[model samples]
Target: MKSSLRLLSALGLSLCITTLSAKELTVYTYSSFTSSWGPGPQLKTLFEAQCDCTLNYVSSDDGVSLLNRLRLEGASTRADVVLGLDDALMEQTRALGLVQPHQLELSNWPLNPDLAWTDTDFIPFDYGYFAFIYDAHKIETPVDSLEALLNSDASIIYQDPRTSTPGQGLMLWMQKVYGDDVQQAWQRLARNTVTVTKGWSEAYGMFLQGEADYVLSYTTSPAYHVVAEESDQYQAALFTEGHVAQIELAAVTAPSQNVELAQAFLSFLLSEDAQTVIPTTNWMLPVRTDIELPEVFLQTQPQRIGFSPEETEAGRETWLRTWRNAVSR
Candidate 1:
């Protein structure tokens, strides 16, 4: 009888462990998205409560870092879902064949009409327009256009194009505005550039410290200050040339063991519950058009202009080369 009892106990323990392991869902995303302040905690709770599964978030430093991590891990990645890559990386990510089709019917889902999203492999959760943010108190008159910002001798801090998405957006912005004279434009802008940081946080932090007149960031960036700090001092300068839009996306890994669960999370990201949590937490506009946004979003709508994913991918290397040579001089 004693031997039988011990055997039963060991079997029960093994069963419990197996059950727990079966229900876990792993997601790889950026550090900020999974931080205490970001949506990861709340989303994890919400997802786990509904699905009876443990949601795990493995984080990298930023969006670019997430992409790099996947490249290193390849088909051996444990991630079921990969989140936080932007449209700028869509073509590249697709080319790598790392992610599988989400299999969600996004048609008539109340997504932003401006997006015109039709990708089968990835889903857009949020988006924001790239703009130069400045303190209203310091700059009584902000540059009205990209041409003005690049032409003026106003000391500016921006991220490195090779390293950061905002920097890439500005590179695309410069190309859109300057066309054939983009190299000359880069040289002119380099003359007054306070310094180029490796990432958005460093450049924006330096700008907040009054190190530069403007910092390249999302138009929705000022909404963070308005909602969180109750100070409306920071604002994104609306350029006459329009702004480039960055749509943050989520995808299921090709090697996912839990394809159904991964697809559920992608669908959840587009759901009303998740959409409501994204804006304030991520500091970007929800992709859903039907959801009500903060007043700040209503007030600061900038016209969107940008290259398609194909165009971005094709031109990126040449553009980076041009940026490097122009800025170095």
Candidate 2:
């Protein structure tokens, strides 16, 4: 009878282990996950607790690189979900159809109607406006407009548009403001251009180190500088031409076996708890209308440049061609 009881106990333990293992969900995202600035850990902890699932994160350096990896993996990829693709790459990802539409019960959550894209192919997590982050001490009189930057003596560092989201955003912002005369605008900017880094951090680092007078970054960049780093050297300039607002999105992979869990994770991202953490950590504006702005953000409300996703898609190729021509000249 004792021998029989031992066998039953071993079986029960094995079943419990199997049940726990089945609840784990794996997520793939950008390398930003490793930073305390990112939402990865918080997301993992919250989701695991709510859904009784273990959260696994796989990270890559950039969104485009992650998308490319997803393509290479086809339907067999281990990633159940992907986060960090922005408006710039949304069309490309949508065209690839690598992600399935997320049908979550988000009726209780108040999402910005304007931020939604195509029946929830992707959900906007956080957003921010793009601007020039410059050293207040280095620049005697900071350039207040795109034209000023074009004509000023201050060295400017920006990421390359083809590779960086902020670079693409600035490119689109220029096109929106300059219209048909955008080629000329690029010509004007090229004259004062110092260098183009591969990503935002590198460009911002150069600005902080005083290598350049300005770096292309978000309007909330000053918030990070003040609250996180406790340095006032960096401040985002208010430009007359308006700032480019970029929204980062999250989506469920088409082949993900854990669709319900992925959808739950998406809903949790927009929760008040998650939204509250974003301003402090990622330097982004919360999509939820109810969340209060942090003190640093209260000083600088990001200016909205008038450019729709449709306009962005229509002009992107032409703008790139013109940008290349202008750079070469």
Candidate 3:
């Protein structure tokens, strides 16, 4: 009886060890990334087949909020990977040392060099230009530039600069357009706003509901309507002053015990399968030039407007203050 009991104990211990080895990778990301329409579901399905591990997503409001939450969690963070931050937030994120450097070789991947790859920590996954999306059916004449957006009486919906990436992009884009007079520009633009939301999804939803004439959204947003809904009524207005290109990124956390698994997933992000999933799902441009984009992508005349990591880090607080002061008027 004693020998049989000891044998059962050994078998139970082996089973426990086997179960513990089945890794569950925790990914912290923006809500949009894990949305039904986003590439998250498809990508998760694809990666899981090869990984022999389950992916667990803990989605936050947006990229900034994700980073803020990580900061709060610090060394005790459960996130093995984070997949929504943009280049604008790179410097700040790197400074915190919240994530480990992505050790992947870019030359071996489908990585785009035009993303202006600067940080060794954040890996570029997808990108798009910030633009005012308007339903062509609603407005006869869309605003052509930031100057027109400010001068016209068209009601717009935008995210708040404090909480949203697009909102941050607008503030920075305005800085590029108006130079030292950005505050005056915001004051003028604020009069045209219907309401400010905390994130991109909320602002875009209001526009879609006809609550506003235009929305602060990506140039690629129309591609979703063009391809999936088979509708061409929505379009991004070309701007003379230019649009800010936002490159969304992914990074592995330093505190994660599943580093190899997290890194493997990061590698999978650059795969052709993942790149193919981005355009219509995330409504963003794939980093790989190999994928054939939907024809609606032709409508997006994206202008490059980005800040270096150091430059963004330095002026972030001052720019947010300017945005606050302008909107208050």
Model 3 / residue 301 / CA error / Å: 3.1
Query: Could you tell me every candidate's TM-score relative to the true structure?
Result: 0.90, 0.86, 0.92
Q: Which stretches of candidate 2 lie over 4 Å from their true place?
A: 1-22, 112-118
Q: Which residue pairs collide, candidate 3?
A: none
Between candidates 2 and 3, the TM-score winner = 3
Model 3 worst lDDT run, 10 consecutive residues: 10-19
Over 258-311, each residue of candidate 3 has an lDDT whose tens digit, in order, gives 776676777777777788898889999998767888778866666686576678
Residue-wise lDDT of candidate 2 within 1-329, one digit each (tens)? 22332332323212222222247677888776547567677766655665577888887766666777888898999987888878777777777878998764444466666565444678787998899988887666788888788878778899878767788888888887888998898888877778887777778778778788888998888887789778887789999878888988888999998776666666667677777777777788888777888688878875688566666767778888999998899
- Would you give me the overall lDDT of model 3? 0.82
Top TM-score model? 3
Query: In model 1, which regions exceed 4 Å deviation?
Result: 1-22
- For all candidates in order, the CA lDDT equals 0.83, 0.75, 0.82
Q: Which ten residues in a row have the lowest lDDT in candidate 1?
A: 11-20
Candidate 3 contains a number of clashing pairs equal to 0
